[model samples]
Target: MLRDEIITVFGGSGFVGRHVVRALAKAGYRVRVATRRPHLAQDLRVMGVVGQVQLVQANLRVPASVERALEGATGVVNLVGVLNESGRQTFSRLHALGAKTIAESAAAMGIRRMVQVSAIGASATSLSRYARSKAEGEASVLAALPEATILRPSIVFGTEDSFFNRFAAMARFVPALPLFGGGKSRFQPVFAGDVGKAVLAAFERDDARGQTYELGGPGVYTYEALMRLILEAIDRKRLLLPLPWAIGKVIATVSELVGALPLMPVIITRDQLIQLQSDNVVADDAKTLADLGIHGETVEAIVPSYLERYRHHGQFHEREA
Candidate 1:
């Protein structure tokens, strides 16, 4: 393969990054998966022929490391993001400054086609720090590379997604699943694969350059409806309790503390709760799945396939005697 045909994917070991890498590989593009720990992405080797996908260590906080990751690449895709800020990985540094560095590096290397994975609610004035950082990242990427295509997906879902898995696990322990803001918040839950394919498609199409696409699934669901669907998929009849925003924030604060432990926590954070206050769905006027010549997948069709494990008796539970 030509050197310029290689694509460097930052955060390729992450939930969305893995799918993007697989999609790029299938498109006959050599992939360089950049992450802090490259060993964790060894499984990606199966996505393509030997030597087609290479793994390398890259930390967004370090410009030299980021440059090394982007070295010898024709294009780049940034999938690094965080729901909560942590020590040395603040939203400003990782999403904003880090994004600027990557875009500049790619431009300096003569890589014009870049895809930046941002979130749906990205805005400079957004209340959620996550959203603000994402917006900043978009601005920085676009300014650095005017031809960059930025994709903002709304609450991407997949078999290994943290959202559905977290709720399914909760149904196993809690009698009721808490729904923030009366469960009225809506979401468009696009599949991770669809987004990945779209990224690769966009990378190949010059028409997509300088455009911002809002990717979402075919159907939209309220928070309560989503929870119910998850419960039904898991074969659990847990109550969907709606909590006020104030109370939810308090609970989330406590949960953040618990999450600091060596093990994962059972709950989320106040910032996450604040994020829930805003709906996560594609805008009507924005470019969508149909525009990319790809039809969106329904949650009903995909959720049950993986969520069956959370059912009372697993797959066998629904079998007729």
Candidate 2:
């Protein structure tokens, strides 16, 4: 297998990181899963042959830890990101400075293939601090590793994703789902597996180096439509309430405060509200999965399979008499 060469994956224990790690392992690449808690990543071992995957504790906030993770690695991928600021893990610190630290270390090691996972709305001038920090991360990465491949994906959906799972759970409890912005916010949700495959494809081509790709699913869905799908899949009915920006901001502010408690409400944050105001689809001009010769999945075709568990009678109940 070609993967005998070491490929270090930063944040490999995370949601997207797990998928990427499996994909890389399947491609026959030796993988090093780097995260703050290496013990939690023991599950990653089953993805590859015994000893093919190693988990190392690496914190990007500390340059020494990040540099140590990069040692003797031919390739590196950065998948570290956060939705909200928790204590010292601020947006600037984690997204911007953390990315710089990792990329700089990779470049210093002369690693040629570096993949960075970012979001579609990452812009230095964006309204949300999350988006702005993402843009800063991109810039810092490019500054250090000019040939790094950056992938900015739309809302990623999978069985374990927060997007659909949150709404599905909300349908179970709340009679009405409060949308951040009038339920008109648009998104093209890409499958996480597709994004992982794209990362590997990008790693194979030097042409992909120094370039950015935007990945999206085949269908573009409004927030209201998305909620309706979740309800239908979960076999629960609910009202889709459009939250005006002003009301949403206030609610988000309160939610942020409440989430500070020992047990968080899992509520959306102010930055997330700001993000919903903007479109999250891939730009027409950008290279997408299709450009990479990959056909993308639609939410309609894929989501129901996993969501069946939430149905009234479960999978067996769906059997026709």
Candidate 3:
């Protein structure tokens, strides 16, 4: 494969997208980051040489914008997704339709390579709208171009991630943390960088074409166990309350309502509660990080480096080693 090929990445400024872009740049690929806000993606220019990286304003909802972004790109990656529905970013619009638009444009424009980043629990029949829309996106992409690659990753974590960061932030101020469904739901917390590497690997390997890869870390932990891991990382001792499913739903709904206010953090949404009903881990006998030739980063090694910032001393704490 030519390293100098142009690759257009939708949502390239996102948590995982940023890492993917960095990895692609390091691998010698010129990257075009297509996002709704080119201003926000300005920092990506530094990822590559003076002009190796370009940011183009493209909204997937607008087919014309999607097509323009694909111009002069041999490879494309769709990382656009939403955890919750906001003003105009609905799951159906962003995940399903957006992916379809990109896939169709790539196919029509004769773009040979593409990849879609989706979650593990995505299903056409899923109760969670998030999961269902992701499934829809995968299906729509394949319908347009059967050779397009698809990746389904478990809960992705990093210093900038909403998963561990959200809880760590809450632990800093809240007296207690709530665990939905008794925290029994399992998750394989893959590192964000690992996910990026996997994306690049998929693009490099011909065998990965038209195949779905389920990406997960080396270890799996329950919801409660992961919470405890966060607590240990932050060196904070707080009650881990196991809230009932019904009660958790109520709280999540209230939180979304509060999000409607001027300046409220987007806490868990009702769709998230619905997603928690299923374990977010790679399925048995399925190809995973190992198949991608990736030894994913562990929670123990990576989580601490970032979570240390949330510690009492805030990066000044003495290291045991």
1-321 in candidate 3: lDDT tens per residue? 326689999999999999999999988899999999999779999988888889999998789999999999999999998787888999999999999999999999998788999989889999998999999999999998898889999999987998998999999999999989999999998999998998899889999999998999999999999999999888888999999999998999899999988889878998999989889999997789898899998999998788888888888976454
What's model 3's lDDT at 244?
Answer: 95
Clash pairs detected, candidate 2: 3-28, 3-29, 3-30
Candidate 3, superposed: residue stretches over 4 Å from native:
318-321
Write candidate 1's Cα lDDT for 180-256 as tens digits: 88999999999999999889878877779899999999899999999999987888788889899998989998888
lDDT of 1: 0.88
Clashes of each: 0, 3, 0
All models, RMSD in angstroms:
1.7, 1.7, 1.7
CA shift of 132, model 3, Å? 0.4
Question: What is model 2's C-alpha RMSD?
Answer: 1.7
Ranking of models by lDDT:
3, 1, 2
> C-alpha displacement of 182 in model 3, angstroms?
0.9
Worst 10 residues of 2 by lDDT: 312-321
Model 2: per-residue Cα lDDT over 60-97, one tens digit each: 87889988888889999999998878989899998899
Q: Report how far residue 145 has shifted in candidate 2, in Å.
A: 0.7
lDDT of 3: 0.91
Candidate lDDT values, in order: 0.88, 0.88, 0.91
Q: Where does model 2 exceed 4 Å of error?
A: 313-321
